[model samples]
Target: MDIGNRLKTVRQQAQLSQRELAKRSGVTNGFISQVEKNQVSPSIGSLKKLLDGLPMSLAEFFADAAESSSPVVYRLDDQPELGSADISYRLIGSHFPGRAISLLRETMAPGADTGPDLLSHAGQECGVVIQGRLRLTVGEQEFELGPGDGYYFDSTQAHRFVSIGEQELVLISANSPPTF
Candidate 1:
């Protein structure tokens, strides 16, 4: 793989400068510069440090590089799967063209949750519950949402969700800045 090009692309996509990335990754700016210029090959550990500055995992970085078709219809079965064992997300705009935002159909199994840790990212988010119930905590406020309930808020605030009902909960969620 073209590591230099990949690093450059990921950094640019993240809107991070070499200096900013260096500071965040705890590496020298010269090292980031060298890597981007293809002047040096970084060891896996070093590369991992760079990826950390992007605040993204290696799997996510590579996954975004896998090209997909544009301006096409994505059938239900064609949606990409995201998340882990407790939750599953179906990307809504997988085949849509010029998508400026991301949408998801997320399923949270009964008693499942995103953990106690709150997630904060740059974006605006909105969602509508489709089935069961969910407990949403945004910043210092918390709300219990039943089926057909909805919510909208800034994603920069720390937030988390939990399935509070006996059945699985499904939500249709949308986000600007494409956090997915």
Candidate 2:
């Protein structure tokens, strides 16, 4: 998705200028320009702050970009792919309007990791391992979870996940306040 273009469109739809948004969001206009130009990828916190200026929630922003008609059921191949080369994240109910939760089927290749930097944001996350092993790190604690193991934690805390076993890791995970 072109987040920059989407943000620009949303801002224009709201009839707000870059300067105005920056003032309301308490960020520099340069930052807003960079984001809108796709020169930078804003952090989750930064994105939230930017959205706050428009008085829009993350869910609303995504919902607006989603398909107009939401379906009750999605076949296996119907789900949207949202991950990178090392990971396979297929979003469930991706077309659902005003979705409050993001349910995903996540597959991590062996030795795959979220990134070097920890992830922190609002809301909460939960996941259940369906296959292989995963190394989960939340804050300063870390644990190795096998099949059937589950985890739930506040998203505000820094967290990361890594596939530790030789085999790929497959899991079902959900995040409230949907971070696509």
Candidate 3:
């Protein structure tokens, strides 16, 4: 797929400049320019981060909106946005409105990390590692997990994720009040 062209189209549709998207995604403005110019191929994690800045999902980015016949539902909430490109999140219930929980199938590249800052938001989050290794940080505590391991924590506490092993990490995660 011509991802660069697609991103440019969506970004224009959203009425945002490259600088704006870079700021929102915690990426460099020059990187955004390179992506749009097809000069670089971003990793799955990087693409996920860019999509998150648009407040869009990987699924949404690739889906053909022309095929949809259903009405759109606009979500209203005062909660903060939470996510990391290090994990490509595949939302499971995009068609459902007023969903109380968000279910996702996440794939992280090897050595992927959730940037330099921890993330905190409303609600609770939990996930199980399905493959590879995961390094989870919650506030002052840190834990390393492998396949079949799981974790649950209050989302309000600062947390971060990192895929530590040589193989990509796969996780099934859920969040209450829909962190996305």
Lowest lDDT 10-mer window, candidate 3?
A: 73-82
The digit string of per-residue lDDT tens for model 3 on 11-95 reads: 8768899999999999998999999899999999999999899989988877833323324432323222244666677776565
lDDT of 1: 0.87
Per-residue accuracy of model 2 over 1-180 as CA lDDT, tens digit each? 667877897898788999999999999989999999999999889989999999999887777766534578899888999998999999998867547799999999999999999999999999999999999999999999999999999999999999997999999999999998
Model 1: residues with Cα > 4 Å off, grouped in runs: 1-72
The residue ranges of model 2 lying beyond 4 angstroms of the native Cα positions read 1-69
Question: Global lDDT of each model?
Answer: 0.87, 0.91, 0.83
Candidate 3 collision pairs: none
Clashing residue pairs in candidate 1 (N, C-alpha, C atoms within 3 angstroms): none
Candidate with top lDDT is: 2
User: What's the CA error at residue 145 for candidate 3, in Å?
Assistant: 0.6
